[model samples]
Target chain A: MSSRPGVATRARPSAVPVAPARGRRRKRSYVRLVLLLPAFVSLAFVTIYPLGFTVYASLTDWNLFNFGAPVRFVGFRNWIELWRDQNFLIAFKNTAVFVLIATPLTYLVGLMVAVALDTATVGKRFFRVLFWLPLMLSSVLVTVVIGRMMFDPFVGPVDSVLDRLGVPQVLWLANPRTAMMTIIILQVWWGTAYTIMLLVAALESLPPELNEAARVDGAGEWRAFWEITFPLLLPVSSAVFLIQIVDAWKVFDIINVLTGGGPGTATQSISLLVFQQGVQGGNISYASAMAWMLTVTIAVVAGTVYWLSRRWTD
Target chain B: MRRSKGAWFFTYGVLTAWSLLLLFPMYWVVTTSFKTRPAISGGATFVPWVDFDPSLQAWRELFSESTDRWLPFFANSLIISVVTAALASVFGMMGGYALARWRRLGPFASAQFGFLLLGQRMFPAALLALPMLIMFQDLKLLDTRVGLILLYTAFSTPFAVWLLTEFIRSVPVEIEESAMLDGSSRLGVIFRITLPLVLPGLIGVFVLVLAGAWNEYFFALVLTFSESVTVPIFLANQINQTESVGWYFVSAIGILSSFPLIIAALVLQRFIQRGLVAGAVK
Candidate 1:
């Protein structure tokens, strides 16, 4: 991704009385650094400082119970213990399953809707606004509305229809089997909007002549899509895939509002686990260890997605 | 490339169904806000006039109760979002223009730096939960509006830099340089020329950053308790007492929480389109 540095080593005579190139470049570099200084400094306080603090705290035994007590250096104890803990394990599994399931599902639905909108010339702007409605709302707000009003067993329209159809009542939030499923549904509903918009943009950017030429060559609509449009969309698809995976990985609010990681911690995520340990449980150092583990997990997951997409593209 | 009538029909049919499904929950929220208790629990009603008598009891309770914390939380959210948006815009406009034009860090270094900012966006706020609590406690910033404002600014600035850098990049560099040559200071060029050209983009970034802070859940959840709790936290705490609070009030606050962003997003949809497409590039 690098090119040769554009440093021009033009020769100049002393008679011309010109400034030295090195001095000029150095002055420009100083100005650039000054321009960049503020953002870097603020980011250091927010991102770099917090990251360093988190890593350091992970190595100590800093529980809330011992607030006024002297902090003890406990190397790798919190990490090792959390790895073996059942709650952490459950949270890990749930978060992994969520990213795996949600990202691909969002892409599939998003692509279909994007293509449909492309073909349907009528009311494109109207449909775009409708798809974007969910993205405008906060995840917490969306979760609460869906959980209480739309999915409530007794009063929710969903269960109400089921009751009218002679089916018995089923608790969506209480049962372990259905808890995560409900969250996934709400997630797909709330999230697919951005993906759809991105894909629509990608689809619209494609030159019409290419698809038309394919059609002229006797390719059907599906054939044209598979052979022509789909290949061109790979870059956009990879971006959307990686973005959705990251979005779904940090699944806290939806689960919190919908289930509160309940039915005996059935849907507890890494974020929720950290919240419970650090904020609710007041085990600061222990939660920091969990948070560090989560950070590594996210990096690995994101890296693998990027790597896999690169391989496919290659 | 041409479709049969049947195919066109199928496309419209599927889209109409999708649009309806997409709009239903929003409709349900609004209609439920206007319904009485009996009407709410009775069943799903598509028409408010036909099935249920409308009422303002929930809205009234939301605004008037002294013990209720909805209005204060709402105010906290607005203050935090506005201040964060303004501060992030300033930092991003300055830094983003430098990155766009100067190439100060050289090509590879600039790319790496940009990626670093982006990777920060993907960070889990939970990582800061325990640390921020202790840090704010030491600094006496815990549960204060200033604490949330600063935290949100830190959280939002990277995104502002990333997005606004792209926005500035889209404006041709020759324009700024020519202005600079005409007796204008560097900052003068940015203000008099570049900023006006990118004003729409700035508004887009402002609304986008504001939306991010507004929708932020984990920070509001963990960082603040009583003194500076945001609307999301307030509504979430209300959910914990669902036995007493009822669904009507929840619906009302849910509407209150998201209405501003929805309106902004609608008005700035074009800027959003440009930002999203441009944002996906390397």
Candidate 2:
């Protein structure tokens, strides 16, 4: 994970000399501020300002339907309604299930593929490119191609091959349980590419001496991997896990295109529901409340994982 | 480190199986685009001529007949992605350079400022969708490509700044300091010395931002309506109208829109890996 030693080591504060004159130091600081101005201005306008606006909007009874009507401060009414709403509860459960399942699944599968690629002697580059190909694709494309086309019930290859093999048809996206499964499968499919890329790089960077020493000490391949390689990989593995957890919580594009949260909201994610209420349903205040809830949930979950991983690593 | 023949066999076998599973959807998309409606609805056909008759019907429909529906969206995506990438790279480079060379900016240290920028990404885009819609509505910037370009630039700049900072930090300060000592202005040192050294990192930032904007769906779905619909939004809209539109056509559009990124990813695999690792591991 460290950069090339000497190159990245040069930027420490102690490496640069202190400015001799106070006036010149002040002027230099101003120049540095000028350099950061564009990024600060743009991010403030889009991210920071909108964040504040969402907080304020969540407290008010603002509906796009009531055009020109004066907005009223509802004072926790929307937050109160969120817990009582069944749709919101279902979406929350779905998102929780998604993050819980998809994060670990992606990490494990990515590790397996990364190990496979690292162990293989032939066609390593070809397989790397093939496995990394899905990460290049947009989620919408992945859903349309894989979720819709490949998993289509009647004419899909899965069903066709199943029929040929004399097995009953499994509803990939129609039945409730199977619908969630399909979304998870799609997520894992698209997500593991990132995990593989990171882990492969991590694996390649590990010194061969540890595994070689283990092998010489009469360890089998699996034993060597478990005792030597896997422990060494924990840092990168934790990083990948945290990233996947955050991404899995924001699951939207696939569900939107694949099921549209159909099968009776069985696969509705938090973001999808927020979009449904805030944008499509025009209950901006309520949706904003739900969005803030999602934000808080993500922060808590990510913070917990980060804390746990740090403890485990230490 | 030597492996037994059986171990090598197992490794190759596992990799081969996983590769096929990964390749099947891509294969299906490419073949499905060539299939006709009857050919598609009849059953899964793997071959071109034997299982089904290959045709240009989907391609013709997309490119020739429904040109108005997809082309404008395609153009919008191109303009928005390129402009966003360019703006983000420039802003990110400047921000990154400031963080790299300077120790402080007013009350905050450079590292704290960088972390503040990265914190912007933690909030979900869904959280911003409603407020941005209303904000854009008030500003009369709704449903415009320019609005999307600015928003995407903001969304992409944090990672770009973080990544490019690492890249810029790797450039030894002595080079720039020596250039300044040689009577070159600070701006001249940056342009003539620092810029050339960090050019690869700059391109990495540009490509990453371009791909991120190109693949973005939620913001485009929320911010734009008709004229500024990007490629992913257009494809999603097609999915909504599935009754009239065929999967063949959608598959074609998927292949066409995603082809560029796939090629770029393969071509710039090294730079992309560096950028990704820098973002994740650091």
Top candidate by TM-score: 2
Give lDDT: candidate 1, residue A130.
83
Model 2, B161-218: lDDT tens digits are: 8889988999999988887888998799989989998888888889989999999999
Candidate 2 lDDT over residue span A1-314, tens digit each: 11243443354455443433434556776878788888788788867898899899999999999989999998999999999999999999999998888889888888988998998877998998888888788999888777887888877898888888998988888899989988899999999999999999999999878888998999998888998999899999988988898888888999999998989889999999999989999999999999999999989988998999899989
* Top lDDT model: 2
Q: Which docking category, incorrect, acceptable, medium or high, applies to candidate 1?
A: medium
Which lDDT value does model 2 have at B133? Answer: 90
Worst 10-residue lDDT window for candidate 2 chain A reads A1-10
lDDT for each residue of candidate 1 in B1-282, tens digit (9 for 90 to 100):
458787688678878878978888888889888877888766676677787888998888877874255778888899999999999888888778877885538655665677778777677778866778888889999899999888888777777787888778889988887877788987888888899998877887788778888888888887788888898888777778736447787888888888888888888888866766666655
lDDT of 1 by residue, A91-176 (tens): 99999988888888889988888888888887988988788778778888888888766888877888877888998987898899
Worst 10 residues of 2 chain B by lDDT: B236-245
Deviation of model 1 at A286, angstroms: 2.2
lDDT score, candidate 1: 0.82
Off by over 4 Å in 2: A1-20, B242-244
